[model samples]
Target: MSALPYPPPPELGWYDEDATVMPQQTAETQPAANAQPVASAGTTTAANPPTTAEIAQTTAQPTTASQDDDDIDWEGTVLSTAFTASAPKQEYELYNEQTGQRIIVDTGVLLGRKPSQDLPQGVKAVKLDDPTRTISRNHAAISFDKDGLLWIEDYDSLNGTYIIRDNTETKVEHERMRLQAPCTIRIGDQFFTFEQR
Candidate 1:
């Protein structure tokens, strides 16, 4: 889990010493006790209330701002050891056999020589170190579906993409295939291993 960047503390003597500061702001923001609340369909209130039809009409109004559950800040008790506490999110990494480099996979990634422009947001585009020109501009994509599963698909590359499991090479020709950890992924000629931590 990434921690959001918070604003730095104010510098020394930054606050105005002469300016009047209010201790509370509730008085300005609070609604008047006698003010009647505007209602939908008609002038509703505590006394008259609203009919079932009126309630339905108000509830059917279109929502402009929809919030995703992941964007919401959640507070809870977390039991974590020293090692796990530092990295709160479940992480997956790709170990390149040729380059001997480990790259962290967040959401999903696109491994290619030069990444394509037509990529969805939150998906990383990686420039592979392919000296043989075996990898395509957008060779293969590690896709993340809504069901929280990882998948690999070939983007009609000249060579091909494959996933090896139990020494059996399964070609990802056109259709996407589910990718499990501790398996070798073959993008063109280079090989990479997918592992979870």
Candidate 2:
């Protein structure tokens, strides 16, 4: 037969002098109060506890930023195949095949540019001219996925893609960027940077 679980410390006589005591502990630990005998394990009843589903739900919740960053090794390549005139956004996805966290990097949110040019160069062309744009939501981006691949997608703007692999700058004329591990992709004038996720 399975052994009985250990009783919680609260069920015992242990107590902090400064704090109030529970009714169960008072009888066993406080003789001055004229307490009665403590109930045995079979005689005592456990109050409502967390349901199995509730416990599973809490544990299944998405990992926090710190936890996710710490848990995954995160290394892979980036591939982009998205661009349009009105919303010229590209998707930067990684394929690590290890942790299996699909990290997505989009351009529309990363770099802010006009809907005309595919790869608009210069700081001003990327909407960085307006100070508010930076604070707004038009900044360039570089992110990794669960698989550990890096991504650099355009943010549906005039400016195109930029790459800084091994400290060298290169333009991505194609809509997609097939990059290996530990590569950085910059989009628009802001030149967002991202590592393998």
Candidate 3:
């Protein structure tokens, strides 16, 4: 008795020579082994690669401009612009209530005297040259925080800093204070108004 079932299955052989399983090759099906395989219409094959003419023909197909425009994300562009515009700009105007002078605050902070090599960058130092000698070289500083709140700090000046609201005066010494617009900021004898446009 055989140990294997079903005559141990038919012996495997090369497919080309397996006539009982594979159909005989016809002239249409078989080409010379060295010959490149032919490509069908509108198809590409490794051996029969596309010609320049065929490539040009495919690329020459006309495309509508409107169809190209439809691919753009206009809504996203508009939303991004609106988000950028909605962000609070770091811009303020400082009006000298005493002299009717105005200065734009665009930098991070502003000092009373002209900037020197010893001072750090991003601090806009201005020369006030106060004849009263009440203002210090760096009397006070004005800046805006990330939340767009305006802040004023006294640099421990000799005379002192004051914020007057509704005809009342509040002293601000070494500490910082949140500045509200349309109010008076008295740095020594000189008074200024902080405003946002």
Best by TM-score: 1
Q: Which wins on TM-score, candidate 1 or candidate 3? A: 1
Which prediction has the highest lDDT against the true structure? Answer: 1
Error of 2 at 148 (Å): 7.3
Q: Residue by residue across 81-108, what tens digits does model 3's lDDT show?
A: 4456433676777788667678787665
Residue lDDT tens for model 1, 1-197: 99999999886445644234554549898779998777665567787978899889988976533223323433344545553433334578888877787778866788888987666777788888886779898899886665557888899999999999899999998689988898988888888888987
* Backbone clash tally (model 3): 0
- TM-score of candidate 1 on Cα atoms, chains taken together: 0.53
Off by over 4 Å in 1: 1-89
Candidate 3 pairs with clashing backbones? none
lDDT of 3: 0.72
TM-score of each: 0.53, 0.26, 0.51
Report the Cα lDDT for residue 126, model 3: 65
Residue 107 alpha-carbon offset, candidate 2, angstroms? 13
**What Cα-based lDDT does every candidate model obtain?**
0.78, 0.45, 0.72
Runs off by more than 4 Å, candidate 3: 1-87, 113-117
Candidate 2, residues 93-166, lDDT tens digits: the string is 53323223334444322334332344433212223333323222343444444443444444444555567777
